[model samples]
Target: MKRFLYFLSLRTGTELIILTLLLNKISGFYGLLAILTGLHLSSLQLSMYVYSLFALALAGYLTPHLRRQSPIHVLGLAWFYVIDTVVNAVYTAAFAINWFLVIGQHHPTAVRFGHTILEPENVTSISIILMLWGLRIYFILVIMSYARSVLRQHVYSTSSSTGLYRRENPSDPDSGTSIENPFATNREDGKGWEGRLGRAMIALVRSYWLGVDEDDGWARGMGGKFRRSGEAPVTFGPMERERRRRSGTGPLPPPTSNPAGIPWATQGTK
Candidate 1:
């Protein structure tokens, strides 16, 4: 599974985030430059740039948190990226319609290629638009994959640290334990607005946001998680069961409710 981008191989979410911000800032700079150069801008173009400014601010705030395994900030940034993708698409569609359909109809034909009279500017712009949109789709995938990695990493760390986890049998490999995103729309994270907003933002693409995809395993590495049952995954220091046994305690009990502040699972008393 290829976790990173195919060409650059950007492995971490932080790199993806920084790349996103840097590209957007460059875009913003170009927009401002156009304004300075006396290039007349349509209302739609101006609005699109304005929305990008908001995104830049939000992403900037969340960017620093990308380095940390903090779920709230990471999830916030992921949701922002997904929402911005949709919003940007709508703006792009409007711009494309204006450029290709309305404005192109008014333009004088400049180039003749075989049986068709094609404008060189249109051909070049069309090719560039297609390529940019394709790259945008790939960026969304990498960002989501990285977000999933961070969310799962936090969950695994919490489970190991608190010695509370959900498994059919305590001896089962940690790989069998659930690592669902608590902030996902479907998760019963009883705590207020964060879950609600997550649902609202991701409801349209719930499956994509929450479910596994190609290369997710590669993104969610086995440093402290998802090891085979035989490999004996260790979190923190000593095994929880081993410590309990040495202290003259019986095997640990199953988790009653979601421990480690995870609100996604609820197990019966065992």
Candidate 2:
């Protein structure tokens, strides 16, 4: 159920943000504000407002523990909330615009023009508000889309490519593994969780500059020179070497013996 909610949040959030953007494009700022006010007002019609308030309180209460779990998950969840806001904004704009137009017939003077140069009337104000709401929604949707795209690319890149090759004998170097089945897992290939994670981090960094190259096939570059077999080795410069020397003992040295049955270093001879 929790996982379902997580996925649902992502999908709904994306859709909402997109819809919000569309609303803003159709409406403007005052329109957005008016729509928000209307939505807030309408909240009195049901227990939605109470539930929303409660949910927020609960989220705040669990925030510390949630943060400790996985910061990435927290960020993903935030993306969903932003999406939801966009969705709400779009809905509010649509509702406010329709209500204003329908109610305007009964009260024509309520739509009176302002004293400003353009003299935008009540109807114009309502339209502008709707447009603004749409625009805000669009902004949030775009940001969320970009984030999700980046995250997906990261996930793909870090996952193991062992699933890309066919089984092969350990001793037979000449017997090449079949690459026909790109997504087939070969346990002998040494591609595991850790290797995949390293690939993912590297892919994330690379994706920023190169963009996603999804068509290159899943195993294309996964087993190449770029994929690390083990944890990356640390390279120390002169400054680091000096710092290490001053800090304490460096890596432990090998054992040695002196000719006179005493350790060479302990003997203190020339």
Candidate 3:
């Protein structure tokens, strides 16, 4: 029950969050069509629908690159979230105004659904719209939180060979300790989705909301004492330099005098 609650909570996994965003985009698309079919929507609503379509397309293009820690992709998606929020707010207001006016002036005796005559009661439709809007609001906040975390890490974090976040200047001899970025959104290094997806979500929440900044100074002192694990060894050249010397692989040096500075070639000829 506890685990189930966690899953359903606002703090969902990254993939789940993206999935929700995609669904929201799809719903917005269809909702626009429904509104257009039922009534004459203003130019503003039409513009909003076009904007939503563009945002959806941008998100689909950038998602894969964003997962690979591309800063540009992350920034693009962040801007989409912000612009989409404002546009959505405007659209909602417009919708509410139209809905209220319809209820007020066009109070019909009955709404004909094909052959059936049903009493005009928008209560059910309004309630559903409100519920969806409320959920969408929550999702927007979560996405912004996640984006802010990514931006922070992009500015402050360094990359490791494995493409994970590392403390800045990991190769600096005086850098003390190599600290991993706490805000790293990538799944924890391992095999299963549990390690990558579930752990990444938990870590992202902790780093962003719980204030888990990378350990520095005294906490890192002990870690600093251990030799840097991922440092690549410095090699002046090739190992074959010494091996060639031992095996006398190159051209022989010019012949020298045998003894007492006498030339060996001259002595042999004499």
Candidate 4:
């Protein structure tokens, strides 16, 4: 239950930040009122606002805890905010259409979804809001995508610059071999799997802090970090491979390296 609450709070905080930024772009109280009034169902809109406020508060309370989680987990939770925004927008549109139909107001003449457009007076406002929402979504997605790419590149670059993701434990040969992001190991040797994992993680952290995209994938200084990529199966460390093998399971294949030589392994090791 605590974990669930923490997750919810993190999600809420992200949403509040986005909302605050969005509100700042608008005029004043009148602008707020306009946006609020544009909603079709007053009660539902009020409920949404209240819920969002509560979520923001909860998020604030859990900020420190949320930060302890992996970046991937945090990014996934933040995405829920995007989903919520889209859902709320849909509901707002639905409510507006119903209200317009009921009041017999000057409905929009534009044909929409096999029917007449609703709420002509507010059509332009609605369109503008939706467009802005799309832009915001795009901006957030781009930032996250860039962050993910940077992290991946950092991992690759730090692991010997071979760009070939490799697993340790040559006994099984293919068993511990891969070409994806290597896992952190904890074996005895300084050259064991843990060392590689530690290096990759450190590089990811450094890249994240420096705002460097080794891949040059996105614009810098966006501060957003939820970028996604094609499903690239990651390489497991020797320990993980042993665990899997002991459990009678085979690991997933490694991701293909970029032709640009995104190094995945150390050069000297056989």
* Per-model TM against the reference: 0.58, 0.34, 0.45, 0.39
Best by lDDT: 1
Candidate 1: pairs in clash:
none
Kindly list the per-residue Cα lDDT of model 2 for residues 95-120, writing each as its tens digit.
65565556555665656323221335
Off by over 4 Å in 1: 6-17, 26-41, 101-121, 160-190, 198-270
* Models sorted by lDDT, best on top: 1, 3, 4, 2
Regions more than 4 Å wrong, model 3: 1-12, 24-42, 108-131, 152-270
- Pairs that collide in candidate 3 are none
Q: Rate the local accuracy (lDDT) of all candidates.
A: 0.61, 0.44, 0.52, 0.46
Kindly give the stretch of ten consecutive residues in candidate 1 with the minimal lDDT sum: 109-118
Provide the global lDDT of candidate 3 against the true structure.
0.52
Best by TM-score: 1
lDDT of 1 by residue, 1-270 (tens): 135645554346347556766577557657957898899888887877777777777777888887765666777777777788789779877876655555445644523232122456666777897898888777777777677666655555444433323443468564344335455444455257877765564455555545444544543344445443554455334565676678978567666775566444443434
Q: Which ten residues in a row have the lowest lDDT in candidate 3?
A: 110-119
Between 1 and 4, whose lDDT is larger?
1
lDDT of 3 at 194: 32
The deviation in Å at residue 200 for candidate 2 is 14
Q: Name the candidate, 3 or 4, with the larger TM-score value.
A: 3
Candidate 4 structure quality by residue, lDDT tens digits, 1-270: 112124543234444555554453233233336565674536665565555555455434433433353433333334444555666667667786676565444444533532444445556766887798776675455434433443354444334324344444456665534333423353222256545644444454343423322333332222123223443334446966887878879666667765656466743355
Error of 4 at 187 (Å): 12
TM-score of 2: 0.34
